[model samples]
Each structure stands twice: as C-alpha cells, then as structure tokens.
Target: MAREGVTMPATNQHNEQASATPNPFPEPALEYGENPARFLVEELSVDDGEGTSGELMLARIRGLETIELCGFWLAVERALANKESREPRERVERAIRERKAELEEHGEGLAQTEMTPADRRAVAAERDAESVAVLVDEGGEEVSWSRQSGAAVGASR
Candidate 1:
C-alpha cells in the first residue's frame, strides 16, 4: 500500500523474513509506531583518515504523510549524528534552519486569525498540502536543504 510516496509491500510474505533480517545500520531511537523503514535513505560521502568514502545515511524525508513532521525531525537528528566535520555539519544545520523557517511562515498565517475548530483543521490541511507542493517543486525527488527564501517548505505541525 502507498501512503504518500512511501510504498509498503502489498503482501505480508516478507514480514517473517524481514523480521529475521538484521538492519545494516544502527536502529534510531524513535518512538513506537514510527517506522524507520519509511525514512528516505541517501549515500553520503565522508572523509576517513585514508580517503573519502561513502556511507548510507538518512536524507531529509520527502513523503510519508502520517509521519512527515516526525520524519523531518529524525532527518535533522540523523544529519547531526552522522557528521563530524564542521563544514558538512554546518550545511546540514543551515538546511534544517531553512526548513524550520518555511514551516514557521506557513504556520504564521494561522495565527491571529480566529476560526472554528473545523475551519482551523481545514486551513491547516490546506497549508500542509501547499507545503508539500512547495517541497516537491523546489526539491523534485528529494527535499533540498540549500538555502532559499520566501515560500514555506517542508513539514510543519
């Protein structure tokens, strides 16, 4: 089944085998019902003592509607945890800041304006959909962390 852009296997045939298989990377300390498998994976190049090498890492998530906010939070966590160098770490930090700004801008529209609970929910949903559209248009396949101004992007509450 597809939830947002994430695809879950149609059948449970692999459930038993998947449970038996060990995860190649360390399991993230996330809450229950937060499926780490739905997180976007990226191969990042890291500088080792000898030379630069690539490692599998979690990138900023693109889809998964239910956990969009949580996924972005986890992406920031993963980005911080994985980077040791100043330059790379700063880049990740800047990206996260931009994403947060986007969310805040979108949220600001809802502030000061009073509406009924149902109206509030509808407006919130509209803002979320717009945010996703912005992300998709700006980042294409992956949410770009590069600095940009104006439009709100990424996930918010």
Candidate 2:
C-alpha cells in the first residue's frame, strides 16, 4: 500500500484468470482466494503506560478501508515513536523517511481511518494474540517462528 511518492513494481497477485472449463450457463464468476496471513501484524505492541492507546490503535486500524492500507499503517506505526513535540528532530525525520517510500506507493493523501473485513480480522488476531501470557524476549532480536511454541525460537539473523 505505498501511498504517494515512492515507485516500485508491485506484485499484481490480485489478478485472477477465468476458469478454463466452460459452463453451459454462458456467464462467468470471479474466483478469489488468498491467505489473509500476509496482512497479519508482525510484532508485539509496546506497552506504553496507558493500555488504552493500543486498544484505540487497534480499533482505528480495524476501521481502515482496505487490508492493503491497514498493512501500511502497521509499518508506519512501527517506524514512529514519541508523540511529544519535544522529541529530537532526527527521530521524526527517520520515521518519516522510513515510511516515505511506502507513503509514495499508496497513491497520495490516504486516510488512516478504515479497513476491510479481512483487515479487521487480521488486526483482531493481532490484538488477541497480544494477550498471550508468556513470551520469550529475544531483546529486539530476530527469532525463528515455531508452530509448537508460537514464539520466536531464537534471534532472527
């Protein structure tokens, strides 16, 4: 969902071909199937003092118009920190630059307040998964995903 500025060739996976077999009815139907997992949130949310902010974020994200935009929001949010105007300029600049390419890709002036039903489910899963009681902290490191542990087994390279 790159919004406005950066340009890159995107994978056009949304395209689907018509069924090879012909139907006697003459009309055709659209085929649709893609695992919703790609839209899933990747990391845990940082617990800022007020637990309410995260809940709000999730709620707002669920309201976003498309799954594609929701995925982009997750990226931009992760790249940002500190709402304080007093924070260092470099930090804000970095955050903006980190997402500039994406901002460009999403096609101009997009709003962040909506989501598709599929987007809603993906965000809901992320929120539900956040409630899990135990997690091994790899300390800002990468870890291997384990179906058994449902945790990062070790630092990701």
The candidate that achieves the highest lDDT relative to the unseen native structure: 1
Score each candidate by Cα lDDT.
0.40, 0.37
TM-score of 2: 0.20
Worst 10 residues of 1 by lDDT: 55-64
Q: Write the per-residue lDDT of candidate 2 for residues 100-136, one digit (tens) a residue.
A: 4444455323334686445656777798666343334
> How well is each residue in 37-133 modelled by candidate 1, as lDDT tens digits?
3232222456566532322222332122233454454564465455533233444345445555554444422223576545767877897655333
lDDT of 2 at 85: 28
Model 2 regions more than 4 Å off: 1-53, 81-157
Q: Which parts of model 1 are misplaced by more than 4 Å?
A: 1-41, 45-88, 108-120, 123-157
Backbone clash pairs for candidate 1 read none
